[model samples]
Target chain A: MGWFSWGNKNQDISEPSRQNRQKCWETRDSYFDCLDRANIIKPGDEGNSCAKEKQLYEDNCAKSWITYFNQRRVLADAQKDRLAQAQAQADSARK
Target chain B: MREVSHFVTLMFSQRALASLARRTYVGGQQTARHGRRNFSQTLKRQSQFGKDRNTIGTLTPASAAVFVATGVGLYFYFRYEKQKLLEEREKERSSRQYGRPQIGGPFSLTRSTGETFTEKDLLGKWSLVYFGFTNCPDICPAELDKVGTILNKLEPALGKTFLPVFISVDPARDTPERVGRYLADFHPAFVGLVGTYEAIKGACKAYRVYFSTPPNADPQGDYLVDHSIFVYLMDPEGQFVEAFGQNTEADQIAARITEEVARYGK
Candidate 1:
């Protein structure tokens, strides 16, 4: 399809190149995987087709997952501080 | 300017859509006198493509297979070796980054098994310690998972010498039994320790941890404990080896732990 579209120079202004544009569509599979994992794109998820479910997930799930990863870092830092203090105390007692 | 650049990169060279016009221009069939020869040549070329292109005009399936296989083989092999290299790299990374002992002072705790575990236990072997509660929802679960990943990454090398301990902050609820059950979610070798409030407080204070119950009490009378997330790595000498950041990926943590153990002779 990209090969055919390559010669169609008169295509719409908003249209992306067709060469390796198929590669960008690779995210489509993972998008569906994400939706399936989140349980938002099931056999009965309202009227959402694969495209809509994928779009919704790309909009929402991607951000939330990032937030989840970020929060876990803060949690680690707090724990590190507490543990580091214990280490300091032990060092002092050793002296 | 950015839009133009984006348009150029995305619309033009990206898809190679512009390149297709050059290929078909080799001469359309309408311009040919030997139209049958042109069609025959195209069909032969197409069939030759099916059989193998690299073989005919730098198009051989054997060579292509060798080429593609080289790519795919390199891909899978790199994935294979990459996994091993990553493991080796991880092993190297852990050894390199496993800096400084995390346990410095007192780390005394009364275990559910009726044994008192102190820094002395950490002195003779490598230890992976965690300060979390069974009740914690997100933070605790994530940290424990990290500890499990780190241990799994280390246990292979450190063997039985690697000790992964989970000390409960909410001792009242995290009884020995609950701790046992909670360990099920992580590495089996995970040691679950529960003590009285004082013993736990002493341990947490020794570790410099702070935890407060949620301001809004559990409406159903169930309490929520908000605690920090960190996996404490203690050296064989029971000194603080290093503490990994919460956001640190599991592989990195494992790499660090492995590095420290190798340094400490784990």
Candidate 2:
């Protein structure tokens, strides 16, 4: 059921936002890696010691990525619609 | 013997005895034998009566209480076992080929009226949910139409126990107002939902829906969104009951749902 991911790609994002998002994702990844090394399947909540890096990533980069991802999706949708209309117009002219 | 003779003479006169003698006369030995037989019979009858009393007297109150309690307990225990077996058989009879999948969970989206719609809103009624964008070229429109027809047929049989819901997969273009306009062309009772990309994605994931990037789209936004097309039926408890594929006809869906609702209440 995981056919597509919401966090797949945001190529059109600004350089700084992209860097920030990457850094946050990396930080979260590193925390998960640490958990893996420690043989922990799931990290503890805010009160637990293992959540510090993950919390940092959530606070710094996750919000920006969410916004960028949504913007990209909307723009892509608009582009698709424009293409369909152009094709429709061409077909009508030929007819 | 002399005393007995005197009593008998007093009771019956000589003339009467003489007349009785003409009918039949009991000799002394015969009379004694008859008396002994009567005495032995009376003693045996008394002993049998006494034995019956002794048996009844042995049944104390504690033992009587135990006897009554055991009788009642066994009766209810057997009844419970019979009911349990019946329920198991019913479950086996109703077992489905599409085993229960963990589909559906909490989701928050905006209704057509600019109100927040959550999973709680789906409670207390049966719901038929389909995921697609309003701008879908053919499949979405066709499926929605079929759903509308099914709803119309279902209404006569099920009344208002069923709800039809359309959740947008392409939330970017399907605003609440746009969704509302799209649904207006279908069933009047249909509810349209639109939300942020994350919210819509979460809802789709929960329902095991598949959708990917639009195919063959130009720079302009006119392409069709590709997504899985199925109408999901939910029970009153917001659990998944079944899903109907694209080829299923409206009447087929209606009949199946009518049977389902009759067998298991909304």
Candidate 3:
């Protein structure tokens, strides 16, 4: 659900940590900036601006954004997996 | 509060034991330990502080250690319960959580129709709310895909009953038209929302969500937003019923949402 909904408190993405928050913010900004640059460079309202070519630019930007997030998502998943393994090891050691 | 009660119980029981010891020492039932009255008074003050949220009550060394662990356990338990309740409540905000209905604030947001949508509009309908920008690279699309999957799954059971909503965080570029086109890729059933920066900020604040621009090492750049990711379920009558996280399975989410619809008498 969006931020306004209930049941959101338990989300791992909702966890408050300086590093995670910073990383999210940083990555998002860099990606968006890339888009803005693309947005600016997109052929303007001039009659000669090619519609199909402008779409090509937009599509490329969208793909780049997807790639960045997918890489980040993979890293995040790996980190969680590593953490779970460490916790399991600790539990066994305690036992 | 629970912690304080447990401590008070421990202290009282310990006092009873001390009194018994004193009775044996003096060979009389009326006898008391030295400074017993003062110790009891101290505990009373401690409990009061706990009630005020100014201090946490402590127990004897061993008891405190065990109690501390339990307190930690309880904290996590309550957090988990609250999350579940939030999701359930959003599923039936006007209906109930794991418990009873709780009131949420009434707020106004403009939808893609260029019409101002308020909490009132959300009432009498189940809304699956998502937050992201049209420029979002990954999470937003993934989440929206999940939404599409969920809608496809639940449409037969909940046709025209549930509403999927997308609210844009990047107002700098995500106009109503942009959000509309973006959501169209996911589901025709999706409703797009975009408003002034202040308007979106107010809603986010009410929800205790954090979204901020990443500090840039460079000067000229359009920043991205870091926001909470969950699909909020707002029940008929505009109460937050439930929410799902980034990885919540689509079928599971649709099931819970459907269950809420039936259980809430809506």
Candidate 1 lDDT over residue span B14-49, tens digit each: 223312322332335334333345444554455444
lDDT of 1 at A75: 73
Evaluate model 2: give its lDDT: 0.67
**Fnat of every candidate, listed in order:** 0.00, 0.00, 0.04
Worst 10 residues of 2 chain A by lDDT: A10-19
Scored against the true structure, residue B128 in model 1 reaches a CA lDDT of 75
- In candidate 1, stretches whose alpha carbon ends up further than 4 angstroms from where it belongs are A1-95, B1-104, B213-220
Lowest-scoring 10 consecutive residues by lDDT in candidate 2 chain B? B22-31
Every model's TM-score: 0.44, 0.48, 0.51
Local lDDT at B259 for model 3: 88
Task: Supply DockQ values for each candidate.
Answer: 0.01, 0.01, 0.04
Ten-residue stretch with the least lDDT total in model 1 chain B:
B14-23
- Top-down lDDT ranking: 2, 3, 1
Chain A, model 3: TM: 0.35
In candidate 1, residue B164 scores what lDDT? 81
TM-scores of chain A, one for each prediction: 0.34, 0.38, 0.35
RMSD of each: 27.2, 26.8, 20.3
Model 2 lDDT, residue B88, Cα: 93
